[model samples]
Target: MEWNAPGEWTPAAAAEPGQPRKGILLIHGLGDSPWTFVDIAAELSKRGYLVRTILLPGHGTRPEDVMYVTADDWRQVVRQQADAMRRDVDTLYLGGFSTGANLALEYAYDHADVAGLVLFSPGFKSLSLDWLAPALAVT
Candidate 1:
């Protein structure tokens, strides 16, 4: 529950570092942290990709942090992480789950140079917009 605990959101590297050919920016779902993407980031790292599951503004910390965060704050975090990763690799890819997927989509849409995307369980119309409106507004 504490920030940066074991298996928590902190950038990691492969056992044997390799040339950074591809980069993957992993994002977790709403109310979730980067722990979920650890394994995937490792696998991608081993495959010669620079992978990092960043700590979004409201994530990797106490849940209450989310209330003071906004969509723009989250987007800025992704942009900063993505920019750093992109500088070290050839191709950049965005991968995310749920709201993270929405962030990825928005980033990809704005940056046509993004190599590709890998979304997991992206939120669509099935998600309750009415219920989410209040949550989003507080941020």
Candidate 2:
């Protein structure tokens, strides 16, 4: 399945012919797009797993879009994708990078029965204004 969105990167699903589809959801990091997982997805596809990558609402596109998206919105997208994959695959795996990894963890926490999870460079903290309150107010 191909998902079109506003960005330089788009969601893609790749699977080998004749192989039973196995779902692997790849979530890109903050400000990043699904393009980050092209190589990873290709490698997994060669191994016969059905791999899918998604562009988070505010990522892989105009910066303005990011302003309009919230963490919950991203979560909704992941849920929708996982639901779609579950319909066809016997096993489902979730993976992500940075903030995307954080989202993946939240999803896994909610769906512990998932087949597996892969997180790359998970974001524990953000160096943005959202994180500055404590830093500046500490003094």
Q: Which numbered prediction scores highest in TM-score against the true structure?
A: 1
| lDDT, candidates in the order shown | 0.77, 0.75
* Model 2 bad stretches (over 4 Å): 1-20, 125-139
TM-score of each: 0.78, 0.76
For residues 5-89, write the lDDT of model 2, one tens digit per residue: 3222212343345555567888888887787787787777666677778777876556667777788999999999888777767
Deviation from native of the Cα of residue 85 in model 1, angstroms: 1.2
Candidate 2 lDDT (Cα, whole model)? Answer: 0.75
The ten-residue window of minimal lDDT in model 1 covers 2-11
**Collision pairs in model 1:** none
Model 2 poorest 10 in a row by lDDT = 1-10
Alpha carbon lDDT at 71, candidate 1? 94
* Residue 136 displacement (Å), model 2: 11
List candidate 1 segments past 4 Å from native. 1-20, 126-139
